[model samples]
Target: QTYKFRLYPNKKQEEQLLWTLEKCRLVYNDMLAGLNKEEKPNRLKLQSMLPELKKQYPELKGVYSKVLQYEVYKLFSNLKGLGELKKKGRKVGRLRFKGKGWFKTFTYNQSGFKLIDTNKRLKSLHLSKIGDNISIRVHRKIDGNIKQITIKKHCSGKWYANMVTERNNKKHDKKISSVIGIDKGIKYFLTDTEGRRIENSQFLKNSLKKLRREQRRLSRKKKKSSNYNKQRIKVARVHEQITNHRIDFLHKLSRSYIDNYDMIAVENLNIKNLVRNHHLARSISDVSWSAFDNMLSYKAENANKTVVRVDPKGTSQEYKYGRDLDRDYNASLNILERGLASLPQGLRKVTPVEIEPLQKLETISASLIIETGSLFQNHK
Candidate 1:
């Protein structure tokens, strides 16, 4: 698990951190250049080149050794990511060199960083080369063994320390009692099998007016001017605010469901294909169904609950229900039916309640005619 905390670096430490980031960026670009020349790019070979690189560019010695090496790892990591995307038939472009402010993070892998607990409100994060007194706000208790620290500078001009840790997760061993199936939608965030509807907050839509205002102000500024940079940060902050609101909403909603239900059933949607529809793409993206599903899965696992992903092929349309039935609620029932079918006999407790049939003859007749026509055509 990774936990992020705000870093309040003193002026001198901030400058040093920025300098280290710049050096890492240069090193990344340099390694990429070298990799391009090589017939077969090797990780160790690229890492070994760092010493020679430091000798060539003596300014690199100012940064910690492990931090510099991680830059090499980061470059290869990007290459690997592109390779994976290409394997999946994505048209990936080559890695581009990091421009001035484009490079925002540098990591201390395995060592060279320490978190100091002063028994006070504000703690200190000590880095090997940067300094020891960089104040860190430990809002929550750090739970596991710390593995590495990644220092990141956000576009909003705020610094954060992301500490990656590892610990064994103990599954919740309590008996399963409650189960639910949720149908995700743009209109309502989700509709559960119990007929509960959580309204979509539409955070991006709400912030777009202020976002546009900041973006327009940014565009009017001269290129690379002081005002332009200042306005850029303003634009970034608006986007950041929208993101924070959405994440907070998702976290709370997912948490509530996890706390209440022992088993959750969600559609295993192919979101990439769903977004192909240009009209509904914006709405689909705004709802962030995939993120919510992921949250439920991980949270359920940690809580020893079950998260079942039923096939999404016909959840919205295949169910036989009356026209008066809420489409989302109907879909939720279908999802629940599929979820119950997929579970073990022992885990299955409550049987799904049957929806009262108020079938339309016209719909049944039309479907029968289509099926009969297809069969007749095949026979002929």
Candidate 2:
């Protein structure tokens, strides 16, 4: 679970990366549409269709369909999983869009694209217009052989490539090197059973001054003007910096803990309650509580250790109020009618952030997961 999130492009390189995404989208959509109209669409059909489809969309055909070509077929195979779900006719609010601060993108091997560094050369990928062997800056030397590379432009105008690699998890075959319990809290990131404390990164605190200043600058810019666009990029950069700093800080620190003791215990936090306060919304999101849990799970499992999260019921990690240790799992009364009325209206409006791309589930290689209890409970 030692996944690295690195920013890998200089400006000129990033510009062309956008072309790769556009080319991929065009090819993917074309193939998808073509497959939809077929009586029996199969691999050879897709392989044959590429040249014709590209001939029609000369722009896509020009890029030289290599890996992008195979993926079109692979995507068709994967689509079988979703075909049933689509029968319910779910809402699709918008057609897909890629490029700056937008969707995640992939281009295949036949395209002249590859990630690069001062030292090592990664696998070459080619897309139509972008040519083959497009260079990628290797921000850090990766651990495993590169498997797949996806170039993404964040909503913040920052360029990033997520490369997935398969690597042996670090071994931590130490005897219960040490046992520790953790109390997770806002004031303290983690307080262990052995009384060791890890501070909250609080990256937002250090960033707020600059963030507010840049945001204020953005506010003063005339709307939709060159100046405003310029200010928007500036704002995006500030947010990007904050994000990078937080993620880097978390990854390093979590690895540090994993590299140490075995049998690490922690209090299972109720984050929904914490997020109720609007003032803490940004900070909580910045903390990425779910991400932390995800990290701890993978890191511990890969290292052959136990990560036990105890009930928060009698926890006293971050507070000095209300019964000294009891976490009051309070509930507000709601009539039966109110509960039933809330179903369609309230639930439908609550849009959950799409989690389809979370590597946490897919990356856990031979890891053990132990669940203490459910977050949502109903009493009789």
Candidate 3:
């Protein structure tokens, strides 16, 4: 598990943090440069050269040594992954050197980082070479052994610390009971087997007016000027707000489902290919179906529940009782049926009630219709 916190570094400490970021970026670029020249790049060989680099470039010595080492390891890890992809006949791109503003995060592996005042509400982080007691907002309790610390700087001029931790897996013994299948759409974020719906937040679209105003203001500013930089940060913060809100909503919704249900079935959407439809790309991206499914998978696993990804083909096209069912409702029923069939007979508890035909269903509330869209998608 990884817990992220808002970091509050003093002016001097913030300066040191920025300096460390720059040093790490330089080291990343230099390592990539060396790897490009060599026919065969070795991780350990590149790591061994760190001491020599610190001696040559005295600036690097000021930064934590382990942070620099992780940069080299990160490069090699990427390269190794690419090689594996190539072996599987996938087109792989070469590792590129980091340009200015490209690298935003640096990790301290194994050591050089500590959490202070755990008992207190407001805690602080201590890094070996940087400083002592860097104030951080611990919004939630972190329940694990922290394995690594990653400091990241956002374009919004905010600093964050991601604490990677390993926790003892508590296998949940809760008996499998309730099950659900969800169909995701642009209108409602999700429609479940039981006809319950959650409206899409549409965070990006809601913030678009402010975002465009900020971008327009930014574009008018002279490039590289103080005003331009300030405006750029403003623009970044608008996007950041949309992202944070969207993520928060997805987390909460996914967690609620994971907690309540023993099994969750969702469509296996290939979002990468789906987004290529230029007309639907914006709505699809805003909905973030893939992200929701991802959250459900991990959360369900942690709770010893199950998440099944059924093939999305023909789900929307399915019908019942000699008439076309509501698009998402039909898809959800298909999903739920497929999920239950795949599971062992004993585990397929609480079968879903047959949904009434679209014509006979009760009137949907005006507020709900305006909040989302009409329940039924136009069936051509």
Candidate 4:
């Protein structure tokens, strides 16, 4: 598990952080230069040169030694990922050198960072090279043994500490009795088997105008000018706000469904394929279906609930009994049917009336009942 906390650094500490960032960036660029020259560029090999580097350039001594080593490890990790992607037919590119401000975060894989007074209401973070007394906001409690800490400087000029911890595996004991199906869409965030519709937050769409204005101002400023750098931060914060809002919405919605439903069935959307349509790509990306699915899987696992994915083909095109219905609702019904089909006979007892019809101007309750009943009859 990982928890993020806001870090409040004093002026001296902030300068120390900036100096460390610059040294790490230098190391990264040097490694990239070696790689570009077809050198071995191994992490161990690169790390052994750090002592010589610090000796030659005293500025490198400002950063912790382990933090510098981690930069070497990170470069290799990224290279490995790129190689794997290329194997899978992706268009791969060579690793590039880090420009100023491009390398925003650095990690302490196992040492140089610790927590002070964790049991108390207020806690502080200690960095080995940087001074202690860097105030940390423990907004929420976290558990598990800390394994690594990453320091990130956001373009908004805010700092954050991300701690990666190891926790004992949780055994799920919740008994699930209720089930629900969900259909994802751009029009509505999601439509469920109970005919509940979650409205799309559209964080990006709502903030695009402000983002565009800031971005335009940024482009107009002379590069590297004081105003340009300040405007750049403004643009970054706007983008960050959109991202944070979307993530918050996804987390809450996924948690609510996981807590309430025993089993969750959803369409298996091929998002990569769907996004190929240029016209719908922006809208599809905005919905972030992949991120939602990932949250559902992890949350459901911890809650001892089931998440079943069903084939989406023709789900929105036709109802089971050939009655017309809302596409999203119809998709949800099909998902439930497919999900229940795999359960044990004793647990699979959901009936037609339990699934509600989508809202409509003219009532179709009678036809809905007959259509649902006929669906089971035909299947049985």
Point to the candidate with the largest TM-score. 3
Clashing residue pairs in candidate 1 (N, C-alpha, C atoms within 3 angstroms): none
Candidate 1, after superposition: displacement of residue 266 in Å?
A: 0.8
What does candidate 4's lDDT look like per residue over 11-31, in tens digits? Answer: 999998888888889988987
Once superposed on the true structure, which residue ranges of model 4 sit more than 4 Å away at CA?
38-41, 118-122, 172-175, 342-380
* lDDT winner between candidates 1 and 4: 1
Rank candidates, TM-score, best first. Answer: 3, 1, 4, 2
285-319, model 2: which lDDT tens digit per residue? Answer: 76676677777788787678666665555343333
- Clash pairs, candidate 4, are none
What's the CA error at residue 74 for candidate 1, in Å?
1.9
lDDT of each: 0.82, 0.54, 0.82, 0.79
Judge candidate 2 against the unseen true structure and give its global Cα lDDT, from 0 to 1. Answer: 0.54
Q: What is the lDDT for 353 in model 1?
A: 57
Could you give candidate 3's per-residue lDDT for residues 17-91 as a string of tens digits? 888888998999888988988899999999999988888899888888889999999999999999999999999
The residue-by-residue lDDT of candidate 1 on 219-322, one tens digit each, is 89999999999999999999889887777777667777787788888999999999999999988888889988888887787678889999988787875655
